[model samples]
Target: MNTNNVLRQITYEIYKQRTVMPEKMRTNYRIERANGGLLCDLWFLTVGCIHDAQGGCVMCNYGKGSGVVHWDKILGELKKIVERLPWEFEDFLLTPSGSMLDEREVSKSMREDLCGILKGIRTKRFIIESRADTISEEGLDFVKKAVPDAEKYIEIGVESSNNWILKHCINKNTTYEMFQDAVQKIHQAGMYVTANIGLGYPFMSEKAAIINTVRSIKDVLNDGADSVVLFPYHIKKGTLLNVLSENGMYRCVSFWSLAEVLGYFSETELSKIQISWYKDYFGEEKSYICSSPGTCPNCERKVLKELDEYRETQNPEIIRRLREYPCSCHAEWKQQMDRENGQIDIKRTEEEYRKLAEIYKTDRQLLEQEIGIMKDEFMRRYGNE
Candidate 1:
């Protein structure tokens, strides 16, 4: 079967389960201060990301969905979770797989019903997800008229400004132009725009990833997005990334790498728009899986605590301070980065061996023939060695 059919099967299997918990749906909630006050950040994960279902990105396996779920049931489950929230959350952030506003995922009636549901609730701001292609005036109108009391913001997962990475590695069909147009439409609709920039995809150096992400952030903001969210790539179990990692092709971004990216942006640059990391969404655990930046056992907790503070504060000084902290494992992380960039010491050593073989090739048996034999053996054992 093709990728889409495989994804469909996976989603079908998930929906076949008995009851889908909010977390099972990949939904979770957090309380954060936004929109000038503390708000209940409620996230309900729908089946899987729609883009992922349609032969999605390489580094993603979040496509597991329960197929076509009843929108009212989803709303009911969401309402219960909201009511049960302990704090008085004034803002409600609704996140769904792929584009929640996508008609195929959330029908017109579903959007209308969701609007009606929010109309009854007292939310100050409603931040929702939408792919650039899925943004619709009708959907916006439904949300606008239904929740007249709340501010509406649309977040687009532009991922990166580098179309190369988006098309080749990520396989995201959307383009920068499409994203910009979506921002324009959202602005024209009188709603706010938030650009979600992804980091750490294949075929880019650590610096390149950071630079492209920063560029994407600026591009989206310039195009009319009011804020930006940074998502460092995480390795999931069944994604293409996992396969690559198994085949010695990909590595997860280290904390040092993330810090490097964060440090690249000045406070002035970062402050232009509201910025945040996925770490703020579901905590450190959710932000990464295996192959994390190896922090020393002694300072790991302290480092993570400080990192979390920096993520929330966006204080350049915080990142600067974190970057300065001495860690023995940083050398390992640097070496890992080098390996990822194809700068392995073995490659250099292999080059030196080739040079030596060239120099000794004139000798009969002492150096030339023996060196040639060794080179052949080495190359045979470790290609190009």
Candidate 2:
């Protein structure tokens, strides 16, 4: 979506209003105070370090096949960017990919050096991403020593608390115990944490899965994680989800349902949280599974409201056929074709998306072509074209 649009402004607006770290994870420094300087919170690094068997992103490929990304050339460029970037903000963030951050042993020195470079910057906030299993007292201790006084935010890829849900559904390796252990250690060292979670992974009953995901996030927040990154699933071509998309497997919950859940979060919980790219995946104003005022700060509920009005207009015609039916997401869901051709748009209403907090997908580009496609599609679908 055009960054200049009011809808797009949701992102910067959220960033602007977010005065403190989120509920799940937080830093010693107030995110609010530094909001103006966030433009300078540049992430300097190579994207080739991480690996996701399918690819770096859930939807696209970005690993071994993505050409060569040497650590030296990477670091050299990183140092240059760090130097060239205005030394304005108290600090900047270092966001590595699932593959880059997941690399071990041979990649250790590079990772350490990357941290060293960030520390040398003298920024007030320094963050890194790591799988739950990769964190340990030893490595964190080393990082602490190298970057003392900087509030370290270790992003734990604890996509879900349910092991079976994570392993069988998302193919993630880390377990809940591992997540707990990492959080414990980070807290012991007084470091901050941001646990990343996938709200509505496929194959699970939407209601059960969403409730479980929400509770788990609350559990971590209960543990005082500085922030929680709730990434809903997004369906795109070339993914298992994409394959299942035709079978209606990609749809999880509606943004409305997610909003209901967030609305129910305790007030003490509401003010403490912040969001990251709440709706960037679509590059436009679109509907995601999750869309509470706080949860999806980037989505302003305009297009979604349009979709809702479409459904409401179909209610009478839908009930004429279902007879015993009440107005609902399912009544509307079953009549999708009808909704499209003037039969009635009822099917769009009954998607029952509230079962999970939200559903959305993000992709990573391994080449100019792939990036262009995603970027273009995002812009086009959202009206940039």
Candidate 3:
């Protein structure tokens, strides 16, 4: 069986065990800097990611807080939250637990109701997120009609530009071509694109991860991304990454690696980039995050503090200072980066999959059959791409 197939099977098996609890709504509110000013960012829990139910990305554990979704209650709560916000916020970002455009996760009625609430807000810019495949002309038209005066941005996750890496390493099941198509549609709708890029995919050295991420950033920008958001890999509980970390096969992206990626971009390019999921700038849910990007204990706090400040200010000088900051771990990290190949270790990956199957008591034959069917469909869609 192909390595991607095996990994996907393992992911599906693990994800199948998740228990859906009764309805409960959870929301997180934060004040962040965006479009050169303060922004009100609101995150609401939904049912879950539809992709996740079908064995999603290797590193993602989104919608962990999701329960049985109550759309009316969620909208009501959202209205109350928006009503309570001070008039000082010039920008507003509404992020659901999953793709806002995927009706299975967030229904059209809920979105229409949510848009009604947004239409009443006084924000200058309105932002929302969706998967590349979920973006549609109808949805964009509805949003544009609702917030006619606000600058609109649709954030999409394009983790990497390399299809092979996306398939075998991250298992994102999203192609760069799909992202390009989404970008074209968003641009046609007169909306800005915020491409979300992930750093530190498993089975690569820090140096290789940095290179891949930098390449992805450049690719997205060239493909018409108005801005980019860098999400340094977070090891979330119950995620494949967490399993790999426990088995000593993976580590979160190092702070040094993040600095290296930033170093590759000029100050002007850096202005269009935003770093996310670093050391707890957004009041990250502790129950979800097993670990985030960091260095040693000696410099971790100082480094993260500076990174938080940089995230808010987007100052190139802060990145320069980070590069110059001295630490013993920096030399060690560099050595590992230089010594290791970036390729995935197929042997170890397969062994881990087998072990997971054993531990989870998964039916190997049935899983293999499912993977075979998936492989057939994948090849049919993207043959020799």
Per TM-score, the best of the predicted structures is 3
TM-score of each: 0.73, 0.58, 0.88
Per-residue C-alpha lDDT of model 1 across residues 1-385, encoded as one tens digit per residue:
1122222332233233324233345456667754345656555556666666655665555435656565556678777776676554456777665577887776777667666556555666778878888888887786577568788878888888755446544666677788888887888888888888887765445655666666777777677778777777776655555555665556766667667666667677666444344343444555324444436687777877776665456566877877777887766766765665432233333343334334324233343343354345445544752
Tens digits of lDDT, candidate 3, 3-23: 356566667776776555235
Name the runs in model 2 displaced over 4 angstroms: 1-51, 54-68, 99-106, 119-122, 145-147, 236-238, 281-385
lDDT of 2 by residue, 1-385 (tens): 0111211122222223322212221111112122224423333233333333322223322112122345676566667666665454553555543322455522667767766666556666666667776777776765576557777778777776755445434545456778888888888888988887665555544454456677767877876677776655555433445444554655644444344334445545544343333233333322222221121323335434432332323222322223332345534433542333321111221131221112322121222243344335434443531
Q: List clashing residue pairs in candidate 3.
A: none
Which residue pairs of candidate 1 clash?
Answer: 40-89, 47-65, 48-65
Q: What is the lDDT of residue 9 in candidate 1?
A: 31
Sort order, lDDT high to low: 3, 1, 2
Best by lDDT: 3
Descending-TM-score candidate ranking: 3, 1, 2
Model 1 scores worst on lDDT over the 10 consecutive residues at 1-10
Model 1 lDDT, full chain set:
0.62
* Superposition TM-score, candidate 3 onto the true structure: 0.88
